[model samples]
Target: MIGLSLNRVLAVLIKEFKQLTRDRVTYAMMLAIPVVQLTLFGYAINSDPRHLPTAVLAQEDSRYARSLVSALKNSDYFDFVAQARSPAELDEMIRRGEVQFAVTIPGDFSRRVARGDQAQLLVEADATDPSATSGAVAALAALPDQALAHDLTGALAMRGQAVKPFEVIVHRRYNPEAITAYNIVPGLLGIILSLTLVMMTALSVTRETERGTMETLLATPLEPLEVMAGKLAPYVMVGLVQTAIILAMAATLFHVPMSGGWLGLSAGIGLFITGSLALGFLISTVARSQLQAMQMSFFYILPSILLSGFMFPFRGMPAWAQWIGEAIPVTHFLRVVRGSLLKGQGIGDQWRELAALGAFVCVVTALAMARYRRTLD
Candidate 1:
């Protein structure tokens, strides 16, 4: 009896191995997903900002302005790329998002200094992205104290005037404290939702298809929309539970404050969950088996993580990369989440983001419906 049981167990094991080998998607998940995730996280994840593009709009064209420009260029924080001749050009560069900072020197900078009048230097920086903006501002703030002070001392000696005391006040609007947690927590919401909702729906739906239950369900009078809705309702509850857990953890453990109203935040989360579930339903329609659904989910998840500004600041990425990021729904959702939670921005403040996300939901849902209809046919 023991020998017979062993033979039966071995037969089952052989059959399972054959099935596993036959599924290319399973083999890919076993082999490719780990390596890809590791390489992406290891190389791409970094908080330290570097090589920020900066523009100098020097009107002085004097020795002092040249010295200041030289000082900025020598520093590791900036790349002194262009010189703007006028405020219009400077404004264009900043508005076009070509440069993160524009260090402007007044035409009478040297003349005013010679007469011992306090000369003002304008350092206008882009504050759209909190992290890169902070780094650029910090570097610029230090420059006046270090380089300007030395230059002022030399100018005093040249003019035989005494070095007068003055205050260097820094104005950091948008995100004054440069709080990293404030920036990261909101984006994390979108990422966590995407991973959980998308993976769960994709796997669960595919499991039904793999087990032959999908055919049984289709035999019922239920419409495709009804089937999709039934499959998604349970995962929506799961997404809500996960969102609560993450929000609590973020507040209590990480001390990240939620500046927006809870109602608005909840609404945003609901929209995000719906969009992600639609994406998962779309994936399920494309995939024939559970393994294929999982692989396809990973492909979606990878881009969402990398290009969504969750791991890296969006402005810090190259232009081509930024364009790629724009294609992902998580990118728009992150902007809404972060802007609302950290910046205390209301719907009016982020109407653009809201519009974009709404459009994404409409587009993805329509595509999912089309795909689902096709699959049923």
Candidate 2:
């Protein structure tokens, strides 16, 4: 048995701690990532979304109609963002994601209420992301009583005391049954691709450099484009295989609907994969080792999951965080994947996201090429 040496053990412990502290990036990540991610995600995530964008279709100028709308506005769940002139306009707003709820007050709402009759208010909710609108839908129950509370007086007093004075016609669109998997399975594609492709490529160049193979490669007449293509091609293939597997699993296990044409979906996912590879290549230029590459990749993981509409509604986040999410490649990719898979959106419908991914690839590739050392000096 080896003899225990207190002094030697103490010396080793101190040396290890010093080395650990010297690794600023690792130490900062250890301290900051957990705390910051927890706090940030806690505040950013809301199962019950508040101040949801709402469209009002008021054909009547009745005080009662205005009061009912006011009640919804005051409840902190709905914010009247637009006024739709027709039912078709309101439905279009919901489809385009311009608004979450469309409140339609029939022209005779005030007349019905004046006669102590139950007035019907149609609230059509874009429930594609059911979690976002559930709270607001539940909150609508209190509106009828609250709307009539002050308005009912003298002969109209019976309306105030009625158990239910108005009917809230809730039309939950998209996932009408409010399926959770409908939202999650599509998002997993982005998250998985980000983890595998980004982290793998992030370490690719760094590993070669650390092993001194980069020096040998630079001795050859290979141009940067050749080198980049050689390194990226394998990962791109891997990404496609992974994409196929995930999509199959999503369809079979989660019953995720894949609605769009295969060509459009493949094009979008292909662009996303290319962009992720470029981003990882850029990270590889900055990272000195596999551990550093992983740390950098891990730095993005939380933000991808939390801010990219994966764990929560994207529009639910604050403006600054939304801006950050918008800058991330996964955010755009999620839109492409989800829109194509869920809504049957083609390239014409999702061209902007594909273009954004293309732009990301260009920018990251440029930065990576600039940072990549040709001479390995």
Q: Pick the candidate with the highest lDDT.
A: 2
- Expressed as tens digits, the lDDT of each residue in 1-377 for candidate 2 is 89999999999999999988988878887998888688767776666678989999997988888888899989999999999999888876776566889999999888887765767999988776778888899999888778767877775676467556678999887667888888788888999999999999999889998999988988999988788889999998999999999899989998887776466678878888998888898899898778889999988877988888887888788778888888888888887787777667657667777788889888998998999888856
The clash number for model 2 is: 0
The candidate that achieves the highest TM-score relative to the unseen native structure: 2
Candidate 1: global Cα-lDDT? 0.73
For model 2, state the Cα shift of residue 78 in Å.
1.1
Candidate 1, after superposition: displacement of residue 264 in Å? 5.9
Show pairs that collide, candidate 1: none
Summed backbone clashes in each candidate are 0, 0
Error of 1 at 278 (Å): 0.5
Report the lDDT tens digits of candidate 1 across residue range 1-377. Answer: 44568788999999999999898778777788787677555655444566677788888688778877777776666687888988888866664456767778888878776676776677776554566666666666566555555566564754433443222334433345666776677678888899988988887667877898888877778787888898899999999898889888888988776776455565677778888998898888878887698789888899798867787877566566677778888987887776566556566555666666777788988888887742456
TM-score of each: 0.71, 0.91
